[model samples]
Target: MVDFQERDTKRGLREDQEAAHEGPAAEGDGAADEGAPPPGDGEAEIDEVRQQLEERPESDGGQKAHPDESAADPGDDGDHDDHGHEDHGHDHHHHEHDLDELGAAVVTVSSSRTLADDPSGDHVVEALVDAGHDVVTRELIPDDYDDVQHTVDSLVRRSDVDVVVTTGGTGVTPDDRTPEAVRPLFEKELPGFGELFRRYSYGEIGTRVVGTRATAGIIDGVPVFCFPGSTDAVQLGVEEIVVEEAPHLAGLAQRDADEE
Candidate 1:
């Protein structure tokens, strides 16, 4: 009877020990599984990082910026380019108002100079022609106020004469009556012309430019410019001022006629 009891007790103890070992092993396996990552977890993390990089903006140097950082506004860039084009178009349109070619009448008010010996008159004609202007007629006359006035009046009245240029009698001498005679015929006096002439001439002739009466006026829709008698003075006046502004002035002077 005692042997039977001891054998049963030993079997019970062995079963308890096995139960304790099996329970701990099962609990350990469950903990390891909970701590480990799921299948494809590493690939999923890599895909998420790549997507974030793609969403970020890139700089001009091709470096990616922060997600919250922004580049310049595209609309503002477009506006700047459009504004530059607008300013360029405005300047181009303003230049379109100038006449391409015009007819000019050249007169030399010198008692001693004939058409053949008129160096100033020749320079005037050459400069006008070189600038693509047509010389309708050229004349030489004395420095008398009546003759100067009459010749300029007749030239300005001509339909072919868009501008009249006189190269003589603009000095402070006694016979320098071009400005006095021509001033009476002017409907609109361009003081700026004389001012600019003297300003530019001061560089070449020094303060002697004060003695110069280079003048311009508008008469009967024609621009009349009076220059000094010397070849140097005529060259400066025609090349520097008249050739550059004549087309624009002539076009403006005849704008009413053109519109009509």
Candidate 2:
């Protein structure tokens, strides 16, 4: 009986030692490891996640964001990457910034009228403004070749305008020398713009759009979009291309400006 009691005491002591070997946290758990990760590990891991959140200004509660919201985000490819204008190492669907100019300025070409006169011109200005750009200046120059040319030159050379929206004088009339005038000043002629605009206008005016000389190009560090004398045409140009692409396109132009 004495021997049996001694054995029972030793067995109890062994169990006590095993219990002591395990951590206090695992006492209530079943089949836990003595080297198990500590209860504090979870808290410490959470702290690390919180620290990451603090370091990133754009991070909102560890959620991912789209590119348009924050330029700093690695996920944000940039706003100018719509037309794949430049090789950003990604296949873009639209034009990207080739210039650093983000905000835009407007210039409407008309005679005996200002931005307040032509509905087409007014709509163009409003479209640009609604798209979150500024209209630096507006004027009603006569549909004279020399006059239109001088106005455009002044805007681009002075670097006051990121974009110039000219209306009227884009027809087959004698005063329709906008192309001849502006063409000489363009550093890069965007033929696609005119082509696309006319293509869309084809459904409406059919071959009549052929007589229209709507065009777009880059001069100095500015982008110039010329539209027909119609509100519908200007609206189409702004809605389809300008509003969606200008934000990034201007940014690229502005980047170039900054470099200079």
**Highest TM-score, which number?**
1
Number of clashing residue pairs, candidate 2: 20
> What range of 10 consecutive residues in model 1 has the weakest lDDT sum?
27-36
**Scored by Cα lDDT, where does model 2 land?**
0.73
* Model 1: per-residue Cα lDDT over 167-254, one tens digit each: 8899888998999999999999999999998888898999888999889999998999999998988898899999999888888888
lDDT of 2 by residue, 1-260 (tens): 12445654675687567767864654566755555544556457557766776786664686767657745778667776567467755545344444333345555666656655678877877887776667777677788889988988888775556777888888887767788889999888888888888888898778888789888888886778888778788888888887766565556656655767
Candidates' C-alpha lDDT: 0.86, 0.73
TM-score of 1: 0.69
Candidate 1 — which residues are off by over 4 angstroms? 1-66, 69-82
Quote the lDDT for 188 in model 2: 80
List TM-score per model, in order. Answer: 0.69, 0.59
